[model samples]
Target: HMTNLAESMEADLKVHQKPSPVIVRDALGIFLSILFWSNHRPVQLDNLTEQIKTLEMKPLNLEERLEYVLKRGNTFLGFRQLNELVLEQRKLIAKR
Candidate 1:
């Protein structure tokens, strides 16, 4: 979903001939503006504000899925054992 949003915004930014801080700023502004307005827009379909129960979907054995994912590829092993580690990681990313 984040990939799709970045790609769509990149396409929107391509209308400009040159890239600069202002272009990036404007792109972010436009994106945020759309998001701000989108929340207030009327829901034109049923169950638009409904909370979906997990019971509605078929359940899976999470242990099996986690084992499969771990076996299939390399995973980021850091920040798994400690809450402080996760917060530190978030701070580093946010600083960037």
Candidate 2:
């Protein structure tokens, strides 16, 4: 599943290119943390949606977003389908 998430992230970064590749690579460190040390708590999708909005409004850089996600420990819950999560989040954002 982590591989799936990583692949999805790779594809996303390739398409968006908003954050530089270096930033994306750094962000993957957070994912690695999630992969290795997470407590496996299910992250509520609603909470993640709100966090996404907050991060977008603040225009936080990737490092800040990484810290925020690490602090919240949301993605730690074995996210088996990150692609779906991303797509759902995009739809939620588009609604606004």
Candidate 3:
């Protein structure tokens, strides 16, 4: 499912230069669903958080960053922390 989503998003990017918002939303929704199902497993949650932290080091566009937060941020971060991260990203984008 994640592979298919990535392929679809890549195809959309090839044609539109950016992923459609619907695709981003769907991807985030899928991530959230997986997170929900894995919540009972502490090891899985830690692995996912580590994955997110590693990905966070890569340079991503605003939409990708937003998707990252929506999809993975809540897994390890409180609402306030996530909100702060989003706001900080928005400010950075606005500066550009």
Top model number, lDDT: 3
Error of 2 at 11 (Å): 15
Write the residue-wise lDDT of candidate 1 on 36-69 in tens digits.
2334443222332141111122113423332332
Q: Residues 1-96, candidate 2: write the lDDT tens digits.
A: 445545654555567533334434444454433422232333333555444343432222434443554443223231223323334334544555
Candidate 2 to truth, TM:
0.24
Candidate ranking (TM-score, best to worst):
3, 1, 2
> Candidate 2, 27: how far from true, in Å?
1.2
Alpha-carbon TM-score of each model against the true structure: 0.25, 0.24, 0.39
lDDT of 3 by residue, 1-96 (tens): 655655666665556455556665565555444433333322233454455444322223434454555655333232223344434544544554
**lDDT-sorted candidate list, best first:** 3, 2, 1
Residue ranges of candidate 2 with Cα displaced over 4 Å? 1-18, 39-96
In model 1, how many backbone clashes occur? Answer: 0
Q: Could you tell me the C-alpha RMSD of candidate 2 in Å?
A: 14.1
Better of 1 and 2 by lDDT: 2
